[model samples]
Target: MLAPTVGAEAAEAVAGEEAWSVHMQNTNVLQGHTKIRSPYYGTNSLSQAPQMRQTVSLDLLLGLRLWSGAEAHLDGMMWEGFGMSNALGMAGFPNGEAFRKGTASPNENISRAFIRQSIGFGSEMEDSPSSSLFLKGRQHVSRLTFTLGRFGAKDIFDSNAYANDARTQFMNWSLMANGAWDYPADSLGFTTGGAAELYLHDWVLRYGFFQVPTVSNGISLDPHIWKAWAQVVELERKHKIGSHPGAVRFLVYANRANMGSFQQTLNNPLRPADITDSRNYRIKYGICLNADQEIATGVGIFTRLGWSDGRSEPWSFTDVDSSASFGISAKGTAWDRPNDTLAIACIVNSISKVHAAFLRQGGTGILVGDGRLSYGAEKIIETYYDFAVRGWLHVAFDYQFAVNPAYNRDRGPVHIFGARLHWEF
Candidate 1:
């Protein structure tokens, strides 16, 4: 009778532990900025002179363990405010937190809702702690993960530890993501997708398919997944240098949609030829290489190189045909403040010869076009320092300088300054 009672108590404890697997997270970010010393005003330039703009966003992330090796997650978000010139004028825009469409009033949207299942194939086990969208538990090191539902392709592809998150890291669009990959997304940067990942001891492979927006950079996504879709694959390898850790990833993506051809637009003799008039089932593809390495106790380095076929209009992401960026980040442990961080990076963005001619002929892209073109590579340098106020709160100061804004040499050497406040729990 005593042995049976002890067994029953152990079973009850295990059940209670399983029931506590549900978790919730909340994050809020407030960012404000002003661009100073603007360049010559072109018809399509971002607003000249010093103008102040601000944006605020809040996210509620929730996760629940549904069954063995399965979990469900959801995110509710509220966003408001505007970027400089309503997020226009620059290909490598300065504020990553600001949406392209800014509203005077706050708006709510469902950013992510998804289900994930993991299947183990080997006996190796690992402890996975609760972080971001994942729930806390023990997981198999060699396993297969399947995810389905609405999310950003960037959530699973082109990931970099030092340069991924905009709220806490770099503020430029090109620095946050590979500018030339052109991964599919709506105006708000979310889409319905499904992904599968295979994890092994030293490497992982991931593949994803996602829906594209109905129109070019439109807010509404196309429901016809078969007609308009994007696919991506990534291979990642983890290694150690001495006693430090590092990772490298190679990603390639292809997008098929009703997009216009740049050369076709230029050939049309119609007065003020438009790229949109030639829309058809066209394809765009790109590749990216990303790496991150921990050099010292709290110092790390990251870099990315990307390229895309420049014939098609940029369906999503930015307007660059080629890009390269590298940066270094270090924690404040040297000063006995372990939570603080400082980082600096530089990105050079360029377009193809045909792409340059399109802009020179008064054609506009999704993010760029200055009516006329004095073409030069868009070069940008950005840096930021983040100071942690508490375990969940951080304040950061950021700065960026861009030459040849929007690939137009006649336009700008713009200077931007910003501040960000972020809280997560």
Candidate 2:
């Protein structure tokens, strides 16, 4: 949905110009779940349960044009809130110290203040805050976009694409693309910190500088904290096969950092890894294909494939290893009733080791896994319906099922039923 824009409040070099945008969504959900201790410790049993959740968000932006080919912006999230476990999946311990410290809350306060410029002859200046500079020339395409300060690492294809709603809490699992989900405990894998994006033709590359993971520091010396792990850098490419109905995207990415290495340099101030030795690096490569064809009246199909390796050789950790997951997604409007849309999707996740070493008792992140090696992988299936009530409002119903022997031990599956209402303009 596009937010409406109005004329500037002042004409002085476009200064003092401001605009506001808001997004609100709410959802009610019911869920059933069960969990077993471990494969060798429990019998196959299922427990019945139900749950509820709510979410709200708001964004405000202000822009000012400094000179030709240059502009500045202040965009911030004014109101961000989430309640309950509407089945977004846990990114971290939902009730951990981070939450108690207010560092991690259902309600988030995030913003970015940045500027942009175009430096070249024949360059066209566009009012874009996200892209530092974008240039298009005959037979050539290049964009140098850098986002400093703070901003979201979200994209259309993978980042919270399906599960972000004001009425429903953002499903954390939906935030990850193929490579980001390989190891859940690796905090340096993907971060929403200062990052840059460079695009050339069908390819887009990105990298970020963020905080180190798995460290505890005293409050007085918190600002002295330094990063222990390597910064994250990734590359993505999307290309059209031909005029035919097909397109493909490939990704190659790597990041190195010390996960648990932290020490106090002075006065109990936390200092990240200063190791002269080689830092542990985890890398991934993935390819996905998207195709579409109208077989009949308002009917279509979609599919995707993904795989990744979670292990980094020459490292201190030996638990998480290779993992492969794939899914097929299809959505088509009913033949007779073109106004009604039906969508279905299923994704399966597999880990190389039986139990995930990353989420063990001694490990970090969300501990949904059993202490024993997972004898098998986990699976999730989701189906949803989207019906357009108007141009700006939509009503949707969704159902999801997640099954993992390691996390739920003997618990068979967790099922969630949800209802959503969305209004974006």
In model 1, which residue pairs have backbone atoms overlapping below 3 Å?
none
Q: CA lDDT of each candidate? A: 0.80, 0.35
Q: Roughly what TM-score does model 1 have, to 2 decimal places?
A: 0.92
Best by lDDT: 1
Per-residue lDDT over 1-425 for candidate 1, one digit per residue giving the tens place of the 0 to 100 score: 00000001111114233322322333233433345344444444677666678877776666777888998877777788887777777888888877866789998888888999999988988876555576667889999999999877888888787888787788788988898889888888888999999999889999999999888888788888888999999999999999889999999999998888989988987635578988998789989999999999789999999999999888877789999999999999999989999999999999999999888888877778767788999999999999999866788988888898899877767778888887666
lDDT, residue 6, model 1: 6
Q: Score every model by TM-score.
A: 0.92, 0.59
Give each model's clash number.
0, 13
Worst 10 residues of 1 by lDDT: 1-10
Q: Mind giving the per-residue lDDT tens digits that candidate 2 earns over 108-187? A: 33344555443433243333222111111121146665554433333223222222222222221421233232221221
